[model samples]
Target chain A: MEEKNGATSKAGDWRSYERVLLPPVRDLHRLEVYEQNGGYEALREVLTSDKWDPTSVTNEVRNSGLRGRGGAGFLTGLKWTFMPPVDPNIPRFLCGNGDESEPGTFKDRQLMEFNPHLIFEGMLIASYAMSITTSYLYVRGEFADWISLMEVELAKAYEKGYVGKNVLGTDFSTDLVIHKGAGAYICGEESSLMISLEGERPYPRAKPPFPAQRGLWNYPTTINNVETLACVPLIINRGGEWFADLGSHRHPGPVLYGISGHVNRPGVYEYPTGMLITDLIYDVAKGMRGSKKLKAVVPGGSSTPILRADQIDGVTMDAETLRDAGSMMGTAGMLIMDEDTDIVSWLRRVTRFYHHESCGQCTPCREGTGWIENIVTRIDEGAGNLRDLDLLIDLCFQMEGRTVCALADAAAWPVRFTIERFRDEFEARCRPSLVPSGGVLTPALGP
Target chain B: MTDFIKDPVILMPERHPEPVFSTEELVFTAEETRQIATWVSQYPTADGAIMKVLWMAQEKFGFLPPEVIRLSAGALGMPYARAFGVATFYTQYFKSKKGRYVLDVCTCFSCQICGGYDMLHYLEEKLGAHAGETTDDGLFTIQEVECLGACGSAPMLQITNGPYVMNLTEEKIDALIDALKRDQLPFFSSVTLPQDEDDLGGNRRTDVRDTLTYSAPPVAKTLG
Candidate 1:
């Protein structure tokens, strides 16, 4: 388990590095351009190739060991297998989650905007694998531009007979539908995404009646992230083994890391999933914005716990590796903060996001997210008492596993981590001098 | 001094009554009807057309008044209660009147640290309207949002009915507002607008990859 920073960590050998989704070409948003540059080749192969049925395609993916790129690294094959036997009498469906609402994440938008057909090819493969002849791509509102861009590309695909009846001159017919989501982050969650498609309030549903078992108008369905589905075509085009061999152990294949914040160059970097955090920020991102030292990093999306600069050393950028380092690679959206950052204020803003996003489904998340934000806001405003420090962690603990959705857990991570790892930073900002006379602190300190 | 639940914007956004459509019968023009029909054609079940139908109504009549919601409900073949529920639940839909120019500032963690709050204050001072308040002349409204998924730009604001302005500074804000008010929005923010307007169209990449890269042994050679 040897680890190194910057230059040495990446090992220069990019021979296996594959950019299936994001290619280094411009004007590819148009169908003609995309087709010219090897787009839709996988779908054409799948339709016209020899003896490749649903089970074999699923087996190829299973062998590839491709995990869901959407936060939970669940094996795509295993999840697809979870679907109850589809009654041919009733239609089964597949939904692509284009609801890129996760804060600190923007990879999906880039993929869809630039290479829309890649998503379509991926959907075509997925539809074949699960016998899901009909598919829907769900892009949320406020992303009207994304909806517009996807619509244009989808039209071209349909007109070319790539999608819609008798695709590529085959008996199997697959139709691709695009669904627009109203502004709701919870809808990005699979269960909620199903409900949103049915034109309902975007509240996440309970599991056990998982979408795979019964989804979208009470039929069996599978929902995957936009990036996850976009990878399917690649898996089909390239051999699964070659795809699996693209990354470090455990986390395999190329991933789109949306690196943002105080870095000199904040852009999406397509690389193997397990690049070191230092390499992404220092080498690939070209270093911090100014002369300031790196202080903290949210190695995943905003919901993930912040890793102190020291903790980021040798930390590979993947789900298992990040989880081993006490954070989940939920979206791989690294938000970098510099030394001059006021950590308490930053955490307060983070808490505010979860508070705003909590769907009010369960009492704990409904109440606890706002409670954490309030306490953190109090601390940032120079009123946090020593006991309030414990209060923040306790509130987060109560909220973690008690909610219907993971939004509660997302809210809890930043609070618990900041209190546990950066207690001094919290203490430095807990200005007892600003605590009201004979108020919130009087009972704890004296009586 | 309790702030456990005192966030006005989070708890209650500034609301205006449903009057625009109440004053007259809500009707879609032939063009709007054709657009709505096109969106409906994409879905197998018409229920999937609700969001897009709402988008059509909003486009025709700036904000989604109750009457417009009703029209969208009818267009999607869903009940009015269901359409209202969908409309009220999401943040993008405007139930009330909005200024001609709406500025939705993303104040989430990534944006906050990178001068999002500063931009908020500057907008408030310049517009004389806080987050959710429309200016007297009905020119501008500043609203707060969780995130726009543009964290790569740090602090950013999306111009409603227009494009997103990213990596914003105070002076840039002034220049943007000037161009916007003068109705001469020249080429400014590359983060939102199309790349070349001719060739590489639709939300082109703005910043180049500036992070330096380090090399190690090949991933396949080392791990495989």
Candidate 2:
């Protein structure tokens, strides 16, 4: 993918060849305007038209290579394919992840808030594909308006015959309900979400009986992120080939790259995955918003490693390249930090959030994130011995991929990366205070 | 919390003799009410549908006012406090009063890392009140919220009545505020095919194909 360096008279600014994602200024967030602007048409088509086969819809998405936009970047279609074929005789479910709790990730919230109809359309399509009569949009508790938006639109959908039984006058039918989570980050994970939806403690269940085969009341179900569902209609309308052309084969389709940090044009830029980091960082965002020097960027939200200026070049906002650089695009949450920012303090803050949100279900994450938080906090507050650095690093290693879910790993990854790439900084910050104490030995290093 | 959770609304036509109010503060159109009833009937018991019904009522009415909550409670055979607790517990369901348009700023960890603080500050200044406080004009209210899940676009804010403007900047914030002030909300592109042409006002007769074809593709617009 080619990158553009500067602005042009043409809307041709970001890339010589890129389409402005979901264009045309509609009512800022009103469902009425959404209706006026061609929202729910695809769903109307699928429900009302003769060609409403759910299998072909799933096939089109599978061919599109559109991964889950919420985080993890897993293939959306592949996940849907895992659904035990929906038997109308049985009850199957689809839960939309409105729980956008991942640190440095907010794309799902945006998708629902701005273009709620997109999710409604996606929900209907998925329900139609999976033959699910009942679907739920488990929106985060914080999006007060979005929940309302979903309600209004849902009401409209039913009134218009786009939802409810005999949808669009077809034999197939699905009903969508918007459920709200009580402000918990852990709920973003599928099993945890299922647990919460089932009115239990928000604890994750063991997988392989993954949500697809056995989920939500122990029935076969499909749980998807808001963005993943939002991408469904596009794949159906534009065809898989056209969708694949947007990003790389490995991570195809247009990704909503949310550029932040000290950039002038910080906003979500929808583009193909392979767009070069240098072009995105400097040109598209117009560099750091203030005069702050670019120090590092937490490449795919806080869960991914922190990348310095040198690493910015050649980086692609896709899964494989991000992994090659020793980071996963856990969620396409790119948080940029400048030289003026304090990395230690930043990590401490992020760690604190994770600690508070640990859910305490797993011993590793429940205890591990808490320990990391204490060490990082001590380090940030300028009361740490050099030995504390290694201790924190060791805890991170132990925590990675060890828990029942990714929460522990999400908390540990940033700490691990910060220590490895910026150990000297951590050491320098800790040593001066320690030297004054005349300590004979440092703290033990391993966890 | 227990009571609110048990019964999400207090007003109902059956349980209580009178309507929730003499006049509807947030009147639902006949069509909108029918939509609500359709969902209400889906529950095995009327009380089971209280949470969703209140959600629909709160949405129809700007805030879940006392009357509305009571009405919902009565309708669902729920305790008033139970309805209140459910309404208050979920941040999405507002408990306090609000302006005609409320701007929910995303202060989730991701947005915080991505200039969310600055955005909140900017909105506070623009709205002339701190978060959770409505503006003097009563046209707008600004509040900070946890993740709206647009992590990709940090520093974003939801103009209560608008989409999530991600990768947000001060300039974008300014434009959003101005647009809200002018009631110049962004359009929402969708199609509505009424069950019957006569079900709604004559407004239900547009061709979705023509309207959708002329509209910009889904990815082009903002997600609030």
Chain A: TM-score in each model: 0.94, 0.91
Winner by DockQ: 1
DockQ of 1: 0.30
lDDT of 1: 0.77
Could you give candidate 2's per-residue lDDT for residues B12-116 as a string of tens digits? 556544444457453556786676576566533355355566667766766676778776776656687777655554455666668978787876554565567
The DockQ of predicted model 2 stands at 0.13
Candidate 1: where are CA atoms >4 Å away?
A1-18, A431-447, B1-18, B22-24, B34-38, B184-224
Q: Which fraction of the native contacts appears in each prediction?
A: 0.56, 0.25
Q: Is the docking of candidate 2 incorrect, acceptable, medium or high quality?
A: incorrect
Cα deviation of A238, candidate 1, in Å: 1.3
Question: What are the per-model DockQ values?
Answer: 0.30, 0.13
True contacts kept of 1: 0.56
Candidate 1, A90-194: lDDT as tens digits = 888899988888888887877886678888888888998898888989887767666777888898999998998988888879888888776788888888888
lDDT of 1 at B43: 61
List, residue by residue over A207-253, the lDDT tens digit for candidate 2.
87898889887888898887778888777777789888776657877
